[model samples]
Target: MKWLLAMLLLGTCTTALAQEATARQPEPNTRVPQGVMRYAPSGFPDRIVASPAQDARTGFSVAWRTDTTVGAPLLEIVVAGDSPDMGDQRRITATSVALKTENGSAHHHRADVDGLQPDTLYAWRVQGDRTWSAWHHTRTAAKASAPLTLLYFGDTQNKNVSLTTRVVREAMRHAPDARLALYAGDLVSGGDGEDDNEWGEWFEANEVLPTSLVVAPAPGNHEYFEEFEDTPQERRVLGAHWPVTFALPGNGLAEAKRTTYWFDYQDVRVVVIDGTSALDLGTAKAQAAWLDQALASNPHRWSIVLTHQPFFSPREGRDNVPLRKHLLPVISKHKVDLVLQGHDHVYGRLKSPPPVFVVSVTGAKQYRLSDEARRTMRPVAEDTQLFQVLRFDGPRLRYEARTATGRLYDAFDLVDGGERGKQLVERDEDRIDERACTRAETLKGRTDRCWE
Candidate 1:
């Protein structure tokens, strides 16, 4: 009887080993020929972000990722607008290059589809031989003749692809037809692919809507990696993947190039600034001088300013005082309509003198709203994930804040232009209690914890 029991146990062990062996076996035809560098598939359709430029009303830039082996790749484009007929689809092609990530090689592909009709819907896809992704749709910004809606998000620093994805997905569902989406930076964590997987997750999480969504991103401090162990700032990868993936306007502050650029859609002049550059990473004087010229020459009906750091932060030390001193006055003098920023990891909308400054976070990370902030802020949020949807109708703009679960947290409107742009019309609502902290302890592992 003991021998029989031992034999039965041996049989079970043999069965388990066989299953393990089978699972470990590589599929046939999976191996590349010798002398050829094996190209492991990765970074495909990641950070699937978009931006409007080059052709403003008719063109958009798209970026995605893939593993290193896929040499120079190309993008495929298709248009699916209000027309119900399946025959309206049109296709175009674009090229791509590779961006280095720590864990492995990642490629970013971008294409700007031009000659599209204004205020029309379009669908697109990306591919590399056996790796074609599905179709994603986007609506071009409406012409001045009609009203339009846009989506805005901030930070998205922590748990990027995991918890933050839900917030992005929710925002997309809440306003799937939004003409554009804006990001306030820190789009990913771990400067040099230290948490490379998080970047993948960040891209995957937004893939559902990014394929169709137009994205504009400003660089955050997290996007940079201080040179390894006491070396001066060396490997700078600001918007390396960013520009390669999205075809942004090459025209920016003359010195800053793509890092600081401007685009026009209908009546709105959207200017993106690199807060890092203004904060002394390079020549602040040069960037500041350029910003003044850029703002002064704008002729659009409304001007919207975007950056990664807040000019008026509730977090005491985090305020970009130098930047404020240099840029705020220009914004006021030029009658900039709205100023959007992130970095404090909270939401703050303040009615300053001219420009209505708004600081918000759309990622999973959160911070505490100070009591002083409550008194000055038009709307303040703490410990919550949120996004903004902005609609433009000629001279009037309607803005709404939607929570991660698709609840309308806040809404407001702005009307007219020039001097009238200084006046704001805020919607009345009961003040909401601050969101509670989700984790037991804050990730105080770094010095940049003022907001937390």
Candidate 2:
């Protein structure tokens, strides 16, 4: 019965989806940047991001941060309408969590809206004290599988305010219909509370991008901080802002919770693994067991996994051996459609029953390719920042890697053969040639060509 209800009504979401640019101030992207940034909590809310729930068909979530003075933050939402009376909205009090940061203490509020109609557009805003945020738009997933567009980005760890901002802007411009955007960790390099201002910069870089679509991020090691630095009893602690920043699905290992969770968006089952926990802490074996069961019970037609660390590391001599050892067998056996990752600031793609992509999308940081990466990862790149555009239509998935300037860098297609099995076929005849260290002589080396 649940499977039958999963049938969706959206044909091509890229066409029907609403862009946040409409009816807003004459700003270029979606929202204008506010001057005089404040890391400490203010009277109003900031750092607002929406996330797809465990079952996106009927529900979705949005999280925001505010000062402790704003008691009982509220979310106001209504089915999208052109009528000026859209103010007739439903209100839900938010759940708030308090924490002390390097700057000052603040409250992170999360509000989950359930029982919404699938594939419907809705305008929402968060109220803090007496102030309310300008309205933001979001759409729910279809009741069943249909044509969907997704955007994936690598690390946006450094210089988010100046460098990473443009990359994110280009991605939004190129794929305005993308309903979901996943970032493979290292979102903010300001580990723990040492520099919570990076969190403010990150949110500032994207503007309303988080509120416009689902910005589900996989926690990178940088998201963890040492509570007691320079001490013998020092141990790693998850960033206090992580849970407050995202209100993701809770169907994951209780021990890992938000960092390791899964969600079904449209026809795709998306799973996020905590490589930081798997490698840094010691949850590989436990995660492997959970992953096996998670993949085994997948009811969606296609499945993909996201993590900060790649199974095949792209950086020289930097490999996540434990993650590969414990989880590789299960992933290969299950034959997942795709594994999206970021950690090494390089781009590499491999072909197989399940293709893996280690990509970066920040101009702030770049790394050299590994010798093993050179031999194993064809259609590889170094010193290049990129974002991937994915379109899913029934059994076929179209994937494209676009550079920071919105130029096509790599392309491929994954066809689900149902009975025969999934096959990866190249579709990059027009894309620029492979980028690597060897091409320095012919491809202009460090001048224009990458692989530096």
Best by TM-score: 2
Please report, as a residue range, the 10-residue window in candidate 1 with the lowest summed lDDT.
25-34
Candidate 2 residue runs with Cα over 4 Å from true position: 1-37, 192-194, 227-234, 436-452
For 1-452, candidate 2 gives per-residue lDDT tens digits of: 66554444332343355443232332121121344335778878788889998888778898988888976789999998898678689999998998777658888889999989999999999987689888888999975458999999999887677777888899999999999999999898765334577788888888778989987899998888876789987777897778778888888887788699888899898889999899877899999999998889888877889999888886777778998899988888888888999988888886444645545555456667777877877678876778889999988999999888888888888888989887888886778766554334212234333321
* Poorly placed runs, candidate 1 (over 4 Å): 1-47, 81-93, 192-195, 228-240, 243-245, 370-372, 417-422, 434-452
lDDT of 1 by residue, 336-428 (tens): 888889888888888564478888898765666666677898667777788888888877888888778777677777877555444577776
Cα RMSD to native, each candidate? 9.2, 14.0
Error of 2 at 235 (Å): 2.9
lDDT of each: 0.69, 0.80
Worst 10 residues of 2 by lDDT: 23-32
The per-residue C-alpha lDDT of model 2 at residue 140 equals: 91
